[model samples]
Target: MPADFHRIASGRPAAGSTSFEAQVLPYLDAAYNLARWLARDDADAQDVVQEAMLRAFRYFDSFRGGDARVWLLAIVRNTFYSLRMKVPPDGMQETFDDDAHAVVDEQPTPEARMLIALDVGALQKALENLPHPLRETIVLRELEECSYKEIASITGQKIGTVMSRLARARERLRAELTRHSTEVRRHDVQ
Candidate 1:
């Protein structure tokens, strides 16, 4: 569990007056998650987040804050777009396994772990295959658990557009996973 994830007695995020760092710091992992998926490289993601933080600090006064997380994420997403255009994606082929950073309690049996890996890997690859718009929408809505309104704010799309993309993304993901499972079963049968 992240040290920053603590909630107050009401089991809700604590509320307070906004200090730039204080507002942004708690959502660093969320920012990094968005960045990592956008960049598809962990190192690049970190660089994007660092640059995004700086941009946030530079423009702090403009934030007419409603939701600070959305504000920071918008900056992070834009920073990624900037990085993507300025630098070639091929410039860095380096990759890191996210499993390395994930903390697991109590090892699963080998059989269970292998099954889990297969499903997770297939879903991940399927997600990577989705078009950027669909992918981004799904990531914000599902993985980040943002509302349709929040997703629209982050992605600069209408709420209806966000919902449409999510529906399309989910259908594509389901098809991809089903195809993978069928192929695996066929291989096993042979």
Candidate 2:
């Protein structure tokens, strides 16, 4: 290895220090958003992010020559899966009924509605309705803005698999939004 590599590598402040904060803080909200989307609970999401950060700190040295976002997200993904595996089989299953959902109306801005129109909480519930792999792919690609290669690395799947899952996730989300809109219309009709 080139001698300059050591200085470049050691350029970052000590692990878990202010440097870690500088690097990790900006991504915190996004990471938590993703973790919450994946884990489906405030507490569990917090736990996942905390664990991910710790793991990232511990493994910071191994993160040579790669996108930090992907590295951090891979840790987050692993943390989510670890927690997911602990849930009981029955507790892990989710069922979504097309007939029961409502469509989302994107027309009204918050200023127009005088209230937050899009129920992010409801949308989050809908996202949680998806299968784990699909949910992970969606959160990483769409929410976290990870590229195909990054997503592939984080999920330990091939790029093609990431692309496929993202496609499926988009389709599922569209269907879900449509169902939600339909349900809203049904309620309006009644």
Candidate 3:
């Protein structure tokens, strides 16, 4: 948890409502995970989480007492998009794909599955290489283990869109990792 988390928890909600500590603190790491992957930097991730925490505090009263994790995450997602508008773009540059609608969900090769299971570094690099939408979807669904409905809530997209993104993300990751695994094997044969 950030140092700000302790101070932020001081904001007491009304009687019968959950405290900030009880609500958002538990998911701080989750928020950081989402932000870190999205921002693609430790420093920027911290900044994004901090701003998100603050926004959650400001609107803490508005929380209707259901799924604080999802609610806080929605705020974090919004905060990231908001920051993108204010600041210049950073190193993570994935062009928008116009043909995402046409991407067929494909099964991974066995080698791709093995790579994903065994090669954490390669998997991480391939995941980072994905487009932001795909990356975020994978991170949210795989890393955070959010339900499609929760993902839709946090991302403000329909469940179908979330499913589509997750499928696309997985397929792209499979291709990248499979290609990498093949290259590594070729090198070993020499």
Write candidate 2's Cα lDDT for 24-72 as tens digits: 5567677788787676666778889977877776676676755666777
Q: Quantify all predictions' global Cα lDDT against the true fold.
A: 0.79, 0.71, 0.81
RMSD of each: 6.8, 7.8, 8.7
Q: Which stretches of candidate 3 lie over 4 Å from their true place?
A: 1-18, 91-118
Q: Pick the candidate with the highest lDDT.
A: 3
List the candidates' TM-scores in order.
0.83, 0.72, 0.79
Give candidate 1's error at residue 124 in angstroms: 1.0
Model 1, stretches more than 4 Å misplaced? 1-18, 92-106
Clashes of each: 0, 4, 0
Q: State which candidate, 1 or 3, has the greater lDDT.
A: 3
**Positional deviation of residue 59's Cα in model 1 after best superposition, in angstroms:** 0.7
Pick by TM-score: which candidate is best?
A: 1
Question: lDDT tens digits, residues 63-110, model 1?
Answer: 887998999898999999888888876764444464754334358987
What lDDT would candidate 3 get against the real structure?
A: 0.81
Collision pairs in model 3: none
